[model samples]
Target: MKKVSISLIVISQMLLGLTVSTTVSAAAKPITGVNCNGGFFVRTPDKHIHWIDEETEEHVQVYDKSDDIYAMAQCGTGVVTVFEKQIDGEQQYNAIYSPNCMNIGSEKGLSSHIYQGKEKINKIDAKDGKLEIRFVNNTYLRGETCASVSAGK
Candidate 1:
């Protein structure tokens, strides 16, 4: 009985060591991709979008400037509302501006490839005193984020 007990204890210790090592390595490795559920978000107040710079972590509010998606709280989710110029009944959207909060995971950085092709109007709707706009993007981190905008804002 003594011998059997010692063998079982040794075996359990070995398994525990293996598990610990695996968890450590996994945590140390950087994550490449993330789902759009909570990867990022947008807080809109008074017709401005709040953004946190990925590298600097600086609080920036440039309204229509597109940035990176490093973490979930770093603005990787939701549809960032941006106003575009209406040209002949078509909204002209310039790249590097007004991206739906979607973050693509990779080794280097986030992927900003969410384009509407020939289709414009990034899920925009204007009605009463408020407007609900959902910018569109491609890949893993695309979601809708609605906010308050004053009339003519």
Candidate 2:
């Protein structure tokens, strides 16, 4: 009877291991791309404005004069998009929005804004005289950002 009980325990452990592996694999799937039509605005400490293109991965310099720095992302369809932003030594902002250019919704100091959209993950790290923003798409963007921004329904 003892041998039988030990065998059953081993089988249960194997099954548990299999379940955990499956869950991890599903969660670790790579995000291929985002289906958004909007871009993100980032203002560096040197007073330079950078417009990051989500689709083309191009960086455009804007010569506008603005005091506040903000980042926004919008979807392409009518699906809901989740936006999250994290700043060094600052409170994180996480919010849900429709298909439009939604802000990060933070009232912190004016330096830089890092934005991440739905099905996308953003990793931001700032060090001595350098800032890095990495936008990763874990899944496709669902809705349209312009539709929500437009006046029509």
User: Clashes in each model (backbone N, CA, C under 3 Å)?
Assistant: 7, 9
Cα lDDT of model 2 by residue, 20-128, tens digit: 9877655412112333335555545544445466788776554233333333333333112223344564534332333322222321222122333332335433233
How do the predictions measure up, each by TM-score? 0.25, 0.23
Which predicted model would earn the best lDDT?
Answer: 2
lDDT of each: 0.36, 0.38
What does candidate 1's lDDT look like per residue over 11-125, in tens digits? 9999999999877654422223322233323434233344454555554443432322212212223333222444676554422212234322211122232332223434443
Would you give me the overall lDDT of model 1? 0.36
Clashing pairs in 1: 32-105, 39-72, 40-76, 40-77, 79-145, 102-141, 114-138
Model 1: lowest-lDDT 10 consecutive positions: 102-111
